[model samples]
Target: MVDTATNRVALVTGGSGGIGRVVSERLARDGMAVAVHYAGNEAGADEVVGGIASAGGRAMTVGGDVADERAMAEAFDAVEQGFGGVDVVVHTAGRMVLGPLTDFDLDDLDGMIRTNIRGTFVVDQLAARRVREGGAIVNFSSSVVKLAMPTYAPYAATKGAVDAVGLILARELRGRDITVNAVAPGPTATPLFLDGKDEETIGHLSKMAPLERLGTPDDVAEAVAFLAGPARWVNGQVVYANGGIV
Candidate 1:
């Protein structure tokens, strides 16, 4: 068991499922007291927390809409109250609406902007203020930003905003010893990615990487663990976890 003497705390948004779930569990295994944040899936969040506790790690669940500033502030407060103070925050909450730019529903665009863009702002704003010195903040972007996939325009636009926010926030933190970075994963084997994709499409995307397979949630989690823990020198950048896709 890793020693918990350092008292590191982490808040993982969307920690109930997909990439966020693995990230939460990995951080817990690293000895951080984790606040698993979920927007609606209480059962899923509880399952993650339970798994951590079963493995002799400490964790709890926090729930709220990621884009709601007040709700997120409360979520931060809850983590602070539970684990002393937050040391790391991984904002994995996001939405993806795929369609050609000209044909995309305006409402779908609006939702993505709110969840992916505004949500990052809200979470990072509080993380900037609350995360302790020597801490880290990781936001999620997407390899699609570089892949420039046809229907991914709307989703990629939001992640493009995330990339910008992460870069600027790292510089803004200055001497605070907080590293800000974004992790962009490509064609990961998550429920979100597999939801609408057919076998042929999935196989094509899996083979896009030189690795010749879809990334696992654990694969992306390892990247997040590095950024959240010992990667003090890696700041203000996007670490693409896409297996050499770009």
Candidate 2:
């Protein structure tokens, strides 16, 4: 509800991490003032903000637990005060625990749910209330939901909820001139995705996509940029940026 008619601003949660970093950079490059959000990664967030400033783009670092309402609300207020208003919100901070549903530890499942499910709800609730008209809301999902791969049930379950959030919120925001969508990425080559995988497993996954390669952060960021900035007609959709893996 803040006045943001003159400049576009974007607040990207998890902006210090892999996919989020690239998305923040892409949005900044597109002429939007970017708020780089972090959770216990203020240093990383600062680095992102520095890079954006070096590139002559406007950006700042914001920190909060995505599932904590008070902290996130303060973060949102910081951005609105710093950059006029928030026009786009990208929730990319998520927890991924790959284990068979039956064998998964209850504590682990609870942790994942807190971060992935409740976190999404907290962010979306604030975004729906605060984002200026014509803004976009993007929640990150995984292609695993459709692939139905083994040992991915726990993680996919969380992303399934993400998909639902995007769909329902889009409809709920009717006539707000905003676009709500989810981006489902396939296996991407990032530090987070490559940390524990061996070369063989990486090779196998790379071949899963018809494009014969892993998806890049830029590949996913391009989809986000289009939706957040220019794709006004595209709304209430789950756009898969998985190189046709789904």
Using lDDT as the measure, the top candidate is 1
Query: What TM-score, computed on C-alpha atoms, does each candidate reach?
Result: 0.97, 0.97
Error of 1 at 144 (Å): 0.5
lDDT of 2 by residue, 193-225 (tens): 999999999999999989999999999999998
CA-lDDT, candidates in order: 0.93, 0.92
Residue 140's lDDT within candidate 1 is 100
Candidate 2 global TM-score: 0.97
Query: Candidate 1, clashing residue pairs?
Result: none
TM-score of candidate 1 on Cα atoms, chains taken together: 0.97
- Name the 10 consecutive residues with the lowest summed lDDT in model 1: 1-10
